[model samples]
Target chain A: MEIKTLSQDGVTIVTPVGRVDTSTAKAFEDGVMASISACNKIAIRFDEIDYMSSAGLRVVLMAGKKLSAIKGELVLINMPEKIFSVFKTSGFDKIIKICQTFEESKQFFN
Target chain B: MATAANILVLDDDEDTADLFRQKFRHQIMDGIYKFSFVIHPEEALDLLQQQVFDIFISDINVAGTDGISFIAKLRKDYSFMRSIVISAYGDINTLRAVMRGGAHDFVIKPIDFKDFGDTLAKTVRVVEQLRQAEATSRKLSAISDELGVSAQLQRSILPSNSLKKGNIEIWADSIPAAEVGGDFYDFFWLNNAKLGIVMADVSGKNVSAAMFALIAKTLIKSFSQIYTSPARCFETVNRTLYNENATSMFVTAIYGIVDMEKNELTYTNAGHLPIAAIRHNEDPRFLECEAGMALGICEDIVFTDSVHTFSPGEMILLYTDGVPEATDKNGNEYDYERFSEVLRQNAIMSPNLLTRALMESIREFTKGMSQSDDITTLCLKYRLRVTPNVN
Candidate 1:
């Protein structure tokens, strides 16, 4: 899996490509968590990822927890319908901030 | 190991002895070939018993014993030594028989000494490589033994008794993927004889995972005693785990209090799957709610408990992701739909039978294929209501 983390306008965008199941969860978690340490206002793009397991959700949960403790902001952006269903079923969509596109997430980050 | 090799020969003629002494004069001066030529087979056998040689070259005809019989004796007596047969070009049948009897190689009569020397050297090198490989295999087997002992120790700490308490029967069991796992289930007595149910899956495998699970179980058990509410106990345990953790390890758990006196269950599903239940003439379904974030991530998040009131002949199931995530030989996952179907079929059974029936269904679906994660299931059934007027 290719995980690209870029900072633009003080917002770190983590875009992970390919499947993020048990085998790649550790690498994906480390990339996102490192970006959190560097910047608090972060957005993750879920469009590139085709599949994710509970292991992937575990990383997002930890990142959410850590960001919450520091009073920081996190947003899930450009989420596909399939990926959003997972978040919705887990009840994470209710507690976490999400947007339909990066443009929508910009205001939420501010 | 790279030193010159000693050479032994058996032949009847003294000319054969002089040919070797003259031919290897330079090698002898360099301490390479230490040649000993014996005319009689009995004398050569006696010389072999007295000392060792790297190569034993034998001719087809000799005094007292034929060269073929001598080679056979040399093979039986000194199997470590590599024997080379000196045969005439026409003696292909004899050469083939000797090769079959484990001669390292056979050289034609009037042999080219340099080619024979190279063959002997290669044979010795192959033997050394075999010895090294054997030593490494022995060392690895010793490490495997230690892994087995660690798995045994982990199983000993888990409670396996299928016990019943206060009109409730429970069965909680965990089977690891490759001998050990990070999944755990526990049921303990809390305030006012209330049964506290716990089901958790930590993110890891083997020994480190087992150690983390021990810490999680102990902290939850201790914290439950200190706090009366399940939500409070989970919050304190999560705070403790997050503070003590040095690695990125985390646990998704469900901690609940099953109050037999009140016919109620107060639970906090911390980033775990919604609890599965079969209640009062209804189908099997998950008790959906906003499960909080998992433990050992951040310390400040407070968990909230959701309460469920049940009737007699109703059962609650708690499990890790291992059951649905397990794949068959064809790599098809035994998903939630299959799990619910099994629960629906065995809805009215006792806690023990319900758990057994679900496990049997899973086994049938997977068809003995090895799973990648740990499978843990806990069933709590209220055989009779604590207070009969809650309808």
Candidate 2:
């Protein structure tokens, strides 16, 4: 997995590409958690992400709960159709905010 | 921030080439795009040969030859290059031909700059993804290569071939359940008249288990040089291993010293399987020695010493649980009862032949079942007299 971060208007967008399985889950989790101490709003961009397994989901849930405890927002944006389906099937769509576009993601902070 | 796309444009028309170059010049200056231009297919090929490009854009109706043929030749040489065909007049047949010739995308004449830019960006992303996958695959291959070398090293620790010392003929065989296993066996002359034999099984399989097995085997040999008693040898080995090991791993072993001059065998069993002894023209029986706990478990544990009298033409066999617990296609174990029966039947053969026959029987029993653990066995046949023996 490759993780890249970008910040716009104080909201940090983390983009992770490639499969997130058992071998790469720790790196993904570390990347997400590392941003939590500094950023108030964390946006995970899944526009180019291909697939994610249970291990990846566990990290997302952990980051979500951690950010929530700090009274911060954990936003998921531009999820590709394949991964959006996984999110929906896993019931994560119900608990996490899903934005279809970057504009919508930016609006959530405003 | 948007990363610039490094685009290579190949077109024969000077006006079209300049226009293509000018269109990206502003973006290039703004750090959103980078461009390279070539006027001919050969020039494009030469540029590709010189340096790698993120994307290749070529005119379909170039002078001298068509873009389809160029793509075909390019695909033959560099299948990894991402190529796109541009034409003023789009032909369905030509489009199909260029696509079949390995063009990544087709653009109609009077290119819509927005669509073109998007296609170029997507192409660059595809190329980057491919490069990343290749790098990861190479790294994985390197790790696999290292694992193979470790497995080879593990194999080297086993006895090379069968050998005879004095009146005792020793033969051993080991088969790992995977690329590497935890089972090991070794034999060396303890003295001019005493030969030492050892067989052990580590708790797990693969590299970690093989490493521990090597450590245990080394400790046994090193300790045996100072302690003549089998129990004392195991005690020293256990203490050393217990201090060195951080993980909660253990090993079961059988160590014995065979005195060929007196025809006596003294051994200690460290939570290992029972040893079988068959005397000439007598029924085979388990050695029934007092067993001790596995090594590297607790430092205070003690191993008991056991002695047995060996007569001429007698045989002793030591093995790991992998042998008796081996299951067949029917899920039936080749248990101790069947193993003893096979050993008794093959008792008349030489130690080497008997070990081979035992392995053959196991292979037959587990016809379709994959070996689930490491199988190791050591045999020592005592020949009383040094005279010419009948085969």
Candidates in order: C-alpha RMSD to true structure: 8.9, 22.6
Q: What is the TM-score of chain B in candidate 2?
A: 0.67
**Model 1: CA > 4 A from native:** A1-14, A29-42, A48-50, A61-74, A80-96, A108-110, B1-149, B327-333, B366-370, B385-391
Candidate 2, residue B14: Cα displacement in angstroms equals 3.4
Task: List, residue by residue over B257-345, the lDDT tens digit for candidate 1.
Answer: 98877788889877787899886566787997657767776676677888998778788999987887777877677888899888888
> In CAPRI terms, where does candidate 1 land?
incorrect
Query: What is each model's TM-score for chain A?
Result: 0.95, 0.94
Model 1 lDDT tens row, A1-110: 88998788889999999877666888999999899999998899999996776668768877887898798889999999978866765446766888998889889777
> Residue-wise lDDT of candidate 2 within B75-123, one digit each (tens)?
6676556888887886888889889988888789889878887787777
Angstrom error at residue B305, model 2: 7.8
Cα lDDT for residue B224, candidate 2:
90
- Enumerate the candidates' DockQ scores in order: 0.20, 0.01
Per-model lDDT:
0.79, 0.79
Best by DockQ: 1
Evaluate model 1: give its TM-score. 0.61
Give native contacts recovered, as a fraction, per prediction: 0.05, 0.00
Clashing pairs in 2: none
